[model samples]
Target: MYYIGIDLGTSAVKLLLMREDGKIENVVSREYELSFPHPGYSEQNPEDWYRQTLDGLKALVSVVDPKEIGGISFGGQMHGLVALDEEDRVLRPAILWNDGRSIEEVRYLNEEVGKKVISGYTGNIAFAGFTAPKILWMKNNEPELFARIRKIMLPKDYLAYRLSGSFCTDYSDASGMLLLDVKNKCWSAEMLKLCGITEDMLPKLYESYETVGYLKPEIADSLSMRHDVVIAAGAGDNAAAAVGTGTVGRNKCNISLGTSGTIFITADSFCVDSNNALHAFAHADGHFHLMGCMLSAASCNKWWMDNILKTDRYAKEQTGIVRLGENHVYFLPYLMGERSPWNDPMARGAFIGMSLSTSRADMTQAVLEGVAFATRDMYEAAGSAGITPERTMICGGGARSPLWRKMISNILNISIDIPACEEGPGIGGAMLAMVADGKYSTVEEAAAAIVAVKSTCEPEPELVKKYEERYQSFRKLYPALKTVYGEL
Candidate 1:
C-alpha cells in the first residue's frame, strides 16, 4: 500500500507518495501566490491551495496505481485564519502565520488581558501571528466579514476539510492557535470567551495520527483513488517535521533551518518556561514539547545572496569564508522583525562591527553566524526549563549547507545529526498516514522504523571555545540595541 503526504506550505503545496515500507515513490510541488495587501500583512486565497494540491496530487500518483494508495495526511503552515461562511464558502483570504497586522490585538492580549492569564489558559502568550490575534483583528477591522464567519479553520485544516468533508484539526496544529489548552489537549473556554467565538465555530480536534475520515466520493473520483482512502488528522509543520526526523519521545531535539528557524525540544510531560519565552505545545507523538521560533533563518542567507550580492552561486559564496569563528562582523537576523524569546515586531536587522576593511565574505559569514547565535538564544531558553538537548537532528534548506551545519554545531556546542532523508514536513505527513493506516502502531514506532541518520557533525573543541567567546559578545548586541529597535 502507498500513502500520500500533502505539505501545504506558505508558497506552495508539495505532495509526496511513499510506500508502506518507508520508501519515497514520487514527489510533486505546485506553487501559488502569497499576497501582501499592505506592508507587514500576508494573505493567501484558500481556493488556490485546494486547486494546486489537487493538481499536485494527480502529478504525484501519475505513475502508480491509484488503488494502491491507502491513506492521505497533511503537514501544513500553522496559525493562519481561514474563515468559512454558512454555505461553506471561503469568507476571505487567510491571514497567514507571517502576517504582522495584529499588533494592537496582540498588545491587548498580552497587556490588558495579561500574559500570566493568557499563559495560564493556553500555555503561551500572545504573538502577532497567532490565530486568536488574527481573529481579534478581523473583528476589529473587518466587522462584516467577522459577522459572516460560521467556521474558523487553520490553513491545512481547510485542505483536510476539502478532501475528507470533515471539519477537523489535530492537537499538534491546534496548539498554535492560542485557543487550545495545550496541557489538557483541548480548546480553552476562556480563550473562546475572549475571542467572542463558540466551540461550535471550531473544528473537532484529533491526535495527529488519528483517522479523521475517508475521502469524499467526489474527491476520490476526481483523483481516481479509492473512496475508502483514509484521511489522517496531521500536524503543524514543525511537529510533523519532528516526526519525520524521529525527534519523538522525551529529551529529543530537532533544529529546522527553513525560512524560519526553530529549536524543538520534546518532553514526556507538559512544561512551560517561567518567562513564557518558548511555546508549550502538544507533540504529534501524543506528548508535549516546547518550541522556540526565529522568524528569519535560511531566508536571510537567500536575501544576502540573491538580493544583495546578486548571485545564484550560493555554494561558491559560502566557500569564500575561510574564518570559522574569527569574523568581527555580526548580523541580527530580524529582517522580518522577530518571534520566540523576543516578541518585538519593531526589531530590525543590522550589521555591526563593519569597517572599510570588511570584505563581502565577512558580511556573508556574519549572516550565517548571526543565525546560529540567535538559535543559541532559543537553545539557552530551553536549558532554562531544564531541558538540555545534548545533540539535535538537523533539517531544512539551511541544513543542506555543510558550513552552516558546522557553525550551528559549534556555536551551540551540540552534536548535529543529519537525516538520511531531509524531506521535512512532506515525509512526516506520510508517516502520520502510515500510523493511521496501521502500518505502524504509533508515531514513535513509525519514525523509529523510517528515520535514518546519514551523518553527524560534532563540535570541535577549539572552534567551540572561539564561538563561546563570540556568542557572549553576540548576546550583548541585542540588549544594547533593544532601545534603538524600539525607537526605530
Candidate 2:
C-alpha cells in the first residue's frame, strides 16, 4: 500500500506518494502566493492552501492506483494562526510563523505578563512570530474577529480539518502555539486566560502519527482515492523534518537552513533552557526535544543573490569566495528580526569590518558564515542544557551548498550528514501515515527502518579554530548595534 505526505510550506504545497517500504513513487508541488499587507506582516489565505494541495494530490497519485493509497498525513509550517468561525469559514488570512506584526504583544507577554511565568506555563517565551502573540494581536486590534473564533489551529491542522473534519492538531505543531502546556501535553489554562480564549476554541491534541479520522468521502473521491483513507495528525515542519532525517530517539540532532534555520535535538526527557533561549517542546516520536529557531537563514542568501546581485547564479557567487575563515568582513543575518537567543523583533541586519580591500567574494562569504554563526549561537544554547550531539542531519536549500555545510561543520565543530532521502518533512509525513496504517508499530521504528544517511562533512581542526575566533567577534556586532536598531 502507499501513503501520501502533504507538505504545506510557506510558498507552496508539495505532495509525495510512497510505499510502505519507503520507496517514493511520485512527488508534485503547487505554488501559492504569500501576502505582505504591511511591512512586517505575513499572511496567506487558507483556501489557497487547500486548493493547491488538492491539485498536487491528484498529480502525485496519477501514476499509481488510487485504491492502493492507505493513508494521508502532513508536515507544515508551524505556529500560523488559522481561525474558524461557527460555520467553519476562515475568519481572516492566516498570520504566518515569520510574521513580526505582534511586536507589542510579544513585549507584553515577556515584560508585562513576565517570561518566568509564561515559560512555566508553556516551556517557552513569546516571540514576535509565535501564535500566542498573534492571538493577543487579534484581541487588541480586531476584537470583532476575535469574538467569532470558534476553532483555532496551526497551518496543517487547518488542512486536516478541511479533509477529515477532525478539527485536530498534533503536539509537535501545537508546541509553537504558546497555548499548549508542552511539558504536560495539554492546553495551558493561564495562557488561555491571557489570550482571552477558552479551551474549547483549541483543537483536540494528538500525537503526530495518531489517526484523526478517515478522510471525508467527498475529499477522497475528488482525488480518486479511497474514502476510508486514514487521516493521521501530523507534525510541525521542523519536527517532521527531524523524523525524515532519523533525528529521533535520545540525543539525535538535525539542522535545517531553509527560509528559516533551526537546530533540533531530541530528548527522552523534557528539559528547558534557563534563559528560555531554546524552545522546549514535544517531539513527533512520542518524546521531547529542544530547538533554536532563527528567522532568516537561506533567505538571507536569496536576498543577497536576487535583490542585491541581480543574479540567480548562487553557486557562481560562492565559487569566488576562497578565503573561508580568514575573511575580515562580516554580516548579521537578522533581516527578519531574530528569534532564538536575542528574541528581538527590532533587530536589523548589517555588514561590518569591511576594508578597502574587501571584495565581492568576501561579502558573500560573510553572508554564508553569518548564518552558520547565528545557528552556532543556538547550538551553544543546547550545550548549556547538557544536550550536545556530535553530529546532525542537514536539510533544506542551504544544505545543498557544500561550502555552507563545510562552514557549519567547522564553525559549530560538529559533523553534518546529508540524508539519502532529500524529501525531508514530506517523507516524514508519509512515515507518520505509514504508522497510522499499521505498517510500523511506532514512529521511531518507521524512521529507523526508512531513513538513511548519504554522506558526512567533518570539521577540520585548524578551520574550526579560525571560525571560533571569528565567531567571538561576530557575536559582539549584534550587541553594539542593538541600541542603534531601536533608535532607527
- Each model's lDDT: 0.94, 0.93
lDDT of 2 by residue, 1-488 (tens): 99999989999998999999999999999999999999889999999999999888888889999999999999999999999899999999999999999999999999999999999999999998899999999999999999999999899998999899998999999999999999999999999999999999999999999999998999888888888999999999999999889999999999999999999999998899769899999999999999999999999999999999999999999999877789898899999899998998888889998999989999899999999999999999999999889999999889999999999999999999999988889999999999988999999899889998899999999999999999999989999999999998
Q: Per-candidate TM vs. native?
A: 0.99, 0.99
Off by over 4 Å in 2: none
| Residue 211 local lDDT, model 1 | 98
Q: Per-residue lDDT of 86-171 in model 1, one digit per residue for the tens?
A: 99999999999888889999999999999999999999999987899999999999999999999999999999999998999999
TM-score of 1: 0.99
> Stretches of candidate 1 above 4 Å error?
none
